[model samples]
Target: MGLHQGPDPYDRQLCQGSLQRPGEDIHPPRPRGSGDRLRHPRRERGSVTLAVVRVRGIINVKNDIRDTLTMLGLGRVNHCVLIDETPQYMGMVRKVRDYVTYGPIDAETAALLLKERGRLEGRKPLDESIIKEMGEFKSFDDMGKAIAEGQLNWS
Candidate 1:
């Protein structure tokens, strides 16, 4: 006794590399006009406008940062492109310029400044209570005479 099933027709067709699918273009193609290719046609006899800002950086090697800027719609290095200047775009460019031009602070200078700050904060003298408990004595002579001449006693 055996229980067996034959191969599915769809699977057989796929295995034989004869699988077919429907065409993406279902409608009949229409003839394109002169302006049909453009999504936004350019205006005729109007003023052309552009905004340009200087970008400075060492962009020769390690261009991941540059690539990221381009991905966000900024043009290539050393070349200018017309872009829509919105507040958001302005902010993005400002940040990129800051990063490229002004690099990180040096570690030595940072450490020196930190050490100087600690010294300045920690060099305060002893408080007034300790000074007063020393009996307003300004010199070792005052302390010694008071003890030896019996003017002051500690018994």
Candidate 2:
């Protein structure tokens, strides 16, 4: 009765381009907005506020792990740094803008790492020639203009 009932022709292709490529369709836009709803429905809602802390130095890194357990707050580790959400000394922690870890490195080892990094893709060495050429730019605005217009090659 319903036009020789079989699989609905509209379901297969009509819906495909309706939501995506709505411009190609001659039909007026769907009444209740584009038909597709909940594209990524599984994603969770709500914002999570977190305090990030960075641990530096071999000795301090070790100490922070032990101290973080006794400390209040959410604790997580990212790479070599320990981020403690709950800080014991909240006032002192709030003033911290940046944290850095410095490990001892011999000159030869440093030079080897630099050389290896330079050879890697997307890495460039700051050679004297490059530095001298960069010195020609008086300010960051001039450098940005050159880059935006395709005149400068950062790599």
Best by TM-score: 1
Clashes of 1: 0
lDDT of 1 by residue, 91-140 (tens): 55565664332212233432232233212235644333433476765443
Please give the RMSD to the true structure for each candidate, in Å.
Answer: 28.3, 19.2
Error in Å for residue 90 of model 2: 18
Query: Against the true structure, whose lDDT is highest?
Result: 1
TM-score of each: 0.23, 0.17
Per-candidate local distance difference test:
0.41, 0.37
Candidate 2 accuracy as TM-score:
0.17
